[model samples]
Target: MDLSTVTATLASKSYDKVADICDNLMLQVATDGIGYHDDWPYAIHLLSHFYVNDINSARFLWKSIPSSIKENKPEVTAVWRIGQKLWLRDYAGVHEAIRGFDWSQELQGFVAAFSELYTKEMFQLLLSAYSTISIADAALFLGMNEDDATSYVQQQGWTVDSASRMLTVKKQPVVTEQKLDPSKLQRLTEYVFHLEH
Candidate 1:
């Protein structure tokens, strides 16, 4: 494995490329040597999966890790704690986990990227789930303070009632129409007709 490539990829913050790089290197090693990837950079590799929101792959990767490695490295476990929060859809816990862990320099960029994307996703969920929510709740949901949350909501075209301190969320228009592929539908129709005949 080329440590320099991994380092440069992490610095570049191309997380998907990082995943591809690490996974390909591990596959090459496994094919040539023992079938186990015991010496891989399990922490960053697991993080790359999370960065891409590939939760199932991250879970499998975590399980593949040797017990001794997990026991000795608290940072890896700390990274997995965030993954657990994400898996459980624990939004509040996700914020707490990010703040709660003492991340090494290597992991900080990916964790930050994950937090930003997660918050954006939660904002979209808020548009769907709530027409009105208190500033405090919005702050919690967006991982910002009340003041910053107020500004953020206002920037998104959400209006705040000063007396009530509640925000009226401006939701994106929902696409309700399900477009059927005409060719596929016709093929299925013909198949069913042939079967019946």
Candidate 2:
């Protein structure tokens, strides 16, 4: 399969077709001793995995590539770094990393795919810090409207006080057992034995 065809398929989000073409290309390169540069295929494969939220496969692909390739291709390296930040739940780091760089179409698509995940991570970060937060505040933090923020909170099983416009994270209740008196325990044991007879 032509590399341009593979690139076009990936741009069109035909992920399964891209995977098949990439796999065939890899097989050809391996068995026929064909001199094929692996960069483009790897990039497409990485994006395919990212588009599907398959971070483990993406990580494997990123790591399996030659370090020389990583060093030589700045775009690939940048994409890999962003993927790493995403995997690490460093949503802020991903935002910071992509800020000033002019990304190619493929990279732009990859970033767009990750935006929802980034927002989810941001919500988790905020929840970890505060047990209760205002829906307005959550909307602002998540870059969503108030209704959407409220919907998200409700979907997650968090309580929302519409009057206060606040979300309440229900705390798990702690249970404690009362200590038994030794004297009462002996009497209870004797009573149980008598009843058994």
Per-residue accuracy of model 1 over 44-153 as CA lDDT, tens digit each: 98888877888998899899888988998888898889899889988878888888988888888888887888889889889889999999999998888899989998
True lDDT of residue 27, candidate 1: 80
Per-model TM-score versus the true fold: 0.80, 0.54
Q: TM-score for candidate 2, please give it.
A: 0.54
Give candidate 2 regions above 4 Å deviation: 15-21, 98-100, 116-197
lDDT of 2 by residue, 30-51 (tens): 6977666654556666656665
Give candidate 2's whole-model lDDT.
0.71
Best by TM-score: 1
lDDT (Cα, 0-100) at 56 in candidate 2: 89
Q: Cα miss at 64, model 2 (Å)?
A: 2.6
